[model samples]
Target: MPIDPMLYETQFFGFTPQTCMLRIYIAFQDYLFEVMVAVEKVILKKAGALSAVQVRGSTEAFLRFMKQRFDRLFVKMERALLRLVLSVPPTVLLPEDRSHERHPQSREDFRLLQQDVERLQGRYKAELGARRALLAELEVQKAVRAQLRKTLRWLDGLGDAHGPPGLGEMMSLLIQHSGRLRSITEDVAQKSSGGGME
Candidate 1:
């Protein structure tokens, strides 16, 4: 079950959750003690608290423990925090950092990665250019086909109504096709010369 927002609003700190608590540890001779500080009391957050402690020691052995013990502990704590954060069906409590995720690499590895990336981009662009050129040619072919079909239909109508077309009719047909041919040639040439795809 999900916790109610209104219930949280009434029960927990106001809207912001910045207020926290800290627990400090002190060691003297052979004894150790802890102190807790409540920051929420001053900040208006009423429920829940956070705690962290700094260990200090007077004896040589205790001082060494204070200095040496926490390094591994800190590393473990950070790793645990990271795992907990990444595992959560993430919410505002955690922010994902995808940009800086890095793998161990040598200079040669990095150089090879760059080269591979550039090669891939080059191939992709070449394929893309070829695809665009093919599409343009297809469009040109379609227009030419449509023009040819119109001329063919006209010739078929003439043959159906009477017989095979004569000199005058053929001349008119050629004139019409010539205009369409010229347009088709211009379109092909423009595309070949790197003009805008039409």
Candidate 2:
């Protein structure tokens, strides 16, 4: 004898339909935390490697690697996060008890949830924008550092016999540019950490 589909559905999970949806949402949140940790490790590794390398070519390569990794991780993370959010059940308040009229509290709760969802979406977009801007700035810095290294190499080729020109002024300019880059990076970090961008 064939079993009924409803019997299997009811017996397998042993949860009401509404409860199951909530459970799924909770599970997705747990998985997101683990994925986030892995992505953080990747970023840290790339940053450390870029700092240690004095060679312009290697530094550029490291930065490129970081950009690629960030792009891939972000795509996956966004899809998963969006899916979890979209899965949340809509708030519905029905007057199940005939003795009592519909309560205003239900409408208020629904409005609050709607506001929360909008706020979360706004924060997610801001975070994504900040990440993209930071990546672009890092690319620009990489190009500047490569050009500086090339200029230094060319100067080295001009022997001590020629008595190369003083680079004190150039060094100062480079230091200023480096400082600007650091400031931009720190600002991005702060925005991301503070609740402005998730």
Candidate 3:
């Protein structure tokens, strides 16, 4: 059979033993304690009321007494219920999903979590940008080194054909610069290896 929503609604609090009698007893005891305290204060206000001869009250009289005190107690309970309803988390009222999202205790906690996520996203983006720049610089240095080697090869061919006087000096300078570029590229590759994509 389908569940009857009209007969049964959701309850936030759970009770031990889970019996209607226990629920009624707990409700009566809670209100009765407050009512008794209020009655004691009222009796205390009237001088000698406590010291007077205690009379056995009829059931009707006790019921009437409780009826009068319960009015204010009921209003107080209503206000408390309203506050409890308002303070309930929105997640509790919604249908459950299969996502791995954690439920925060309060709005402030949720806001702080959002801020932390945004901070992590920004940090990740910055690291990625730095890595990309390093890779680009490394690639540029490698291309420069290769071009230098190609030019030196062409110079060797010209030297074999009895080229100009300053050609030897130019080849030596180019070789030294090429060696320096190779060292710089090696250093850059080593530094990038930790966080490099390549």
Best candidate, lDDT: 3
Model 3: which ten-residue window has the lowest total lDDT? 3-12
lDDT tens digits, residue span 63-169, model 2: 56765775576557655653454233334223343233443457788899899999999999998898887776666666666665665565466445356535885
Return the clash pairs for model 2, or none. Answer: none
- The global Cα lDDT (0 to 1) of model 2 is 0.57
RMSD (CA, Å), candidate 2 to true, equals 35.5
TM-score per model over all chains: 0.35, 0.31, 0.35
Error of model 2, residue 12, in angstroms: 16
- What is the per-residue lDDT of model 1 for residues 133-153, given as tens digits with 9 covering 90 to 100? 878777766676676677668
Q: Which stretches of candidate 3 lie over 4 Å from their true place?
A: 1-94, 97-104, 163-197
Quantify all predictions' global Cα lDDT against the true fold.
0.51, 0.57, 0.59
Tell me the lDDT of candidate 1. 0.51
As a whole number from 0 to 100, the lDDT of residue 9 in candidate 2 is: 33
Could you tell which candidate, 1 or 2, scores higher by TM-score? 1
